[model samples]
Target: MSLSLKRFAVLLLALTPALIAARTEPAATLAPEANQAVTARMVYGLLSDSRYAYAPRQLDAALEEDILRRYIEALDREKLFFVASDIARFEGYAGKLAEAIKGAGLEPAYDIFNVYVQRVGERVAFARGLLDAGFDFTQDDEWRYGREEAPWAADTAELDALWTKSVKNDWLRLKLAGRDDEQIRTTLDKRYANLERRVRELRSDDAFQVFMNAYAGALDPHTSYLNPRAADNFMQAMSLSLEGIGAVLQRQEEYVVIREIVPGGPAGRSGQLQVGDRIAAVGQGRNGAMTDVVGWRIDEVVQLIRGRKGTDVRIEYLPADAGVDAPPRQVVITRDRVRMEEQAAKSKVLEIEDRRIGVIELPTFYLDFEGRRTNAADYASATRDVARILEQFKADGVDGVVMDLRSNGGGSLNEAIELTGLFIEQGPVVQVRDASKRTAVHGDSSGAVAWEGPLAVLVNRASASASEIFAAAIQDYGRGLVIGEQTFGKGTVQTLVDLDRFARNENQRFGQLKVTVQEFFRISGGSTQHRGVVPDISFPVTLDASEYGESTYDNALPYTEIQAVPYQRLGDFSALLPELDARHRARAAEDLEFRWFSEDVAKFRAERARKTVSLNEAERRADRARDEAQREQRQAERRAAGLALDEGAFDDDGLQADERNVVQDVARQKAAEDRPDPLLRESAAILVDAVDLLAADEGRLAARVLRPGRTSTVWAGGADR
Candidate 1:
């Protein structure tokens, strides 16, 4: 049977009785607003429309089960709030979700959420009571950190027992950090109170977003429903500009943790804030009392932090690795707009063994959409900046170039095509496959070639979407050698649909949905979907591919291929692979920095593999002590080796610390900024090897044919050089 017919049959078999019961019985008392009802209907209409990638698939029993599971997981990811009994009760509506969505009957979702809220309240009260009873730190015990895979509690008694251990663990952590009983009590009380307050503040819009996203995510990971506030945030992120500190924040348990520091933002410029740091409190202006924000909603915290361009916002953050008892440091940042300059491509020259290699580090493939539409001459874009940098490199007589796309999450598909155009003459760059299986080829019409010197593209696991497109194109044509880890597999295209567009009333705010509508493919027939653009040369894998990337998503599209498009084979690097590999291996074996990096990756893997941590106070203390000692020893070794040490490496008493010379501080910062990056240096060395290989007789045919500004004619089989 056809897939759609099979789905329809399954839907009828599973949902017929549920739909009948739903119509006969009164709808559960959710008290959903008129706007929310309109929003739900609009979202369902869009998902079912032919414009979406998954529109061909019906809302069958299988999809209903996925939506049900996704909604439950969204509510209690850690299995801490709801019990197995609650899950069983919700499972009754598992096959009925499709019907509910069609009829705009979101009561089942709201009902499940209400139960989760009630459970959270109960758990909070139980946890608060446990704080008064002092924990026995001497007891030998362990606490599982991430309990997402663990089964839910069987009963209230079991849940209380779990909370007892959790509370004890928290107390032990603080106590090990040298916190007194009174201080520990105060902190725990405040944390619990804040959590309760935040939960209470959850609005209907928030619940709608969570539930709708659960439904959308059943189709694809990238598909999501954003509330009004979240929609605004999404728009700001896409524009690469926002009036705030420019740091990505995520809520972890009760703490707001800094996920990334946007380059050129106030927080990025401060040089004090770091990823994984927890924000404890926020203060307005300079003298406003710090408002504890430990359990505040991420959006609320963001609103509190953002202000007028010139206003000051002070943040109290605890360093990632700092002890619980360690006092939080206050950082006052004058808020400003995060501009294009911050996210633009930057270039530098690296002199490696008499080879002057120009390196362009592209943070993101950003473009000033407004400027482009206005036909502004100074329109900022990755392609424009990169072209200018290439011109500079050519004028300076650089031998080779490296395009560093490491940690670039990707942006602007147009920029990716334009950037790729700077290397290859007019040809098919990427192919787009839509919902109906109709394929469209997107080629660069401009035949302009920028600096086509011996090139290398540096990528890591974080390099995704447009980054994958560019890297795949370059590698497909054999124009450049891809280095580092594989790119993040995110080949699907998303189009944001404003829910307000479908609304009948102008004042109604229905938010938006970022729906996945298309998938991209390389000219070489391979799809950079679940399997990303693999580097020609692989590095020591820092991130486990199984735990990260598109492959990690259960519903991610499978890897596929199509007939190869006709294009010129620029050069054959296959002959030089063995020699280059041997050279890199030899150098890596002797490189201290490489050894250190490999060891770090190994340590991280080991740590991630462990499911539980010792809750026993003595064992925990011993672990912390060993970690600290190793860190200090490493710092000492680096200092002894004449390498620059981190500013935090040295310990200093507050006494006379302020007497330090400003000039000396500035010099130290400059030296640290100029410190050599071991990975980039290695990549440059590899490029140098490529240059040498190209100079050899065996590679002469390929090298002579693949010259800068040379255009090849398309032959019957392929392009002829």
Candidate 2:
């Protein structure tokens, strides 16, 4: 009976495909069924009243034009589905979406999305038909894997050829992976079917969210709209469910992009994934057949990823830092629950010659806001944990400190100020200004200094938000030397608003809107919005800032500066940077580890510069072999030198890759602990040089330590908290 039913269903799909599509139905059904008009008005009203909004106003003709362009781009980012005629048709709605939204009408958004849905069905069908015939890979050809910047197809004929090549490329990838023709065909058939099926599954709410994000994202990339399910997922994460890979995924084009890696999670701990990487496919267990997830809804992909603890889930992802045309890499992650303890600030003392430099590795700036508000004595927070670590460091007779904020995606604003207070007695930490120029200076008022010795703050591309606040404050006060690559430029603040609260229907779930409300600046008068914090002693920047950072967004808030607040300088660290930099460069030149790292980065960048890949099976095999050889060679050299190899977290000995072993997890942590951190070691060495430099200069450090910062006109909430 089941086989008969399946056959009947296939016959039904083949005969009446239009019945499955909403666009072919009556026009009234095409419009959103929910209260999108009310929701859109509520969003606009909130942004309009906010003084810090970068793009709040009655939607003018210019904004309308931008919205229309953005809306279409969101629908077809790769320009594969939409042809010239389709875009030409959409241009008629240009500069008019504002009036439609203002009048509580969303038909225009629906119209565009309906067309996109139809186009996706057409493309998926085209791809499936091409797959049946297969391709002769004997002919030499190249597939343009990167097409975000490609021009739209002039006609359907142009689109057909593009899809032909695309499908051919897909077949070649599987064939090279050693799959039989029958297996490859089955996988491709399922993938194409899923693509079309998921598009059919999309509802009015999904379409509304996409349109709303396009509207909000025009002003700033961080501003976005979350549907009811998405909002619930976000709240669950905030409450710390800690299941799955524990990464925040956002939709971009057809892919689910990694936005943030949750601290203490398998993904963050293993470093197998990074922000901006897009998940292309997912599979279960150690070697389950991969299911193509491209164009699947964000929530659906997430559902596939969420699984039982200690089980393996394989993820195929396009790495963010890997340049265009890079092949997707597969990783098998053993799921584990994230413990809050792992996210807490940790400290260890590094012995450099005759002195001890305390290193505090802060994975994130976490604070239990409700706990703190209720005066819970044991509320978990970054500042409190770091304060305790500092006390321990003092007891250990540590000469200097390194606040390692590497990969520290920031948290509470109040915790940043409190954390800054640990090093400096009292001073302005950050300056925030609104749209109409209402500025508020947040500072630390506590008359307590945890560590007054020479300090260095280690940062990288991932350090952001509150991390920037502390690092910038330390730099402004001359309290510490900011070391490593430039910090992630994300100095904007956002407030989440529940749209349902303002809706007339109490039962209607209008979802949530995350709007940018304020942009903060360093106390030294520069905003870390686009131009992140530059280090006093610089390291070779491995991640390209243009590809990462806030600058990558289309209309991110521009970097600006306000008045510098009054803050006492700790010492003349700037005056000594020249010599300090000189000494750092000299030492790094001869350092074997640093040289190896630099060489690796150079090779990676060179590979990333390519634009296309050969479709020939032989060439593709050679490429994969070369990549594997390079990776194995690096691990071999590290093993030879008795260094730790980055084999990910769950490199199980006896059990399958998917099976969880608590004992193995502990062992892996031990191995990681013993791994030599070349960057931290170098930072400690620099701090040692600074300690000696100050001591030799006779009371320079002492004089710098004596000066305490003065009070400032602070904000209402942050400084005190």
Give TM per candidate.
0.78, 0.74
For residues 1-721, could you state the per-residue lDDT of candidate 1 as single tens digits?
0000000000101123453243222222334565777787778888878766444346888888889999999988878788889989999988778877777477888888777777766776677677777887777887765677889889888888877877776667657667788766766655554455456667778788898999889888888999888987766655556678878777654677786677778999989998778899999999999999976778889989887787899999988778657999999999987663656788999887878889999998887676689987766678988999999998998888899999898888888988999888778899988988888888788877886567889999999999999999988887788999987899888877877765655653989888889889999888999889899887888775687898899888888887788877675567767888899889988776676677767876676667566777788777777767776786787788887664433222111111223234334545655654677878888988777655554534445435333522111011111
Clashing pairs in 2: 51-435
Q: For every model in order, what is the number of clashing pairs? A: 0, 1
Superposed by TM-score, candidate 2 places the C-alpha of residue 418 at a distance from the truth, in angstroms, of 2.1
Q: lDDT per model, in order?
A: 0.75, 0.74
| Per-residue lDDT value at 407 in model 1 | 89
In model 1, how large is the Cα lDDT of residue 513? 88
Instruction: For candidate 2, write residues 312-341 as lDDT tens digits.
Output: 899999886674368999998888765456
lDDT of prediction 2? 0.74
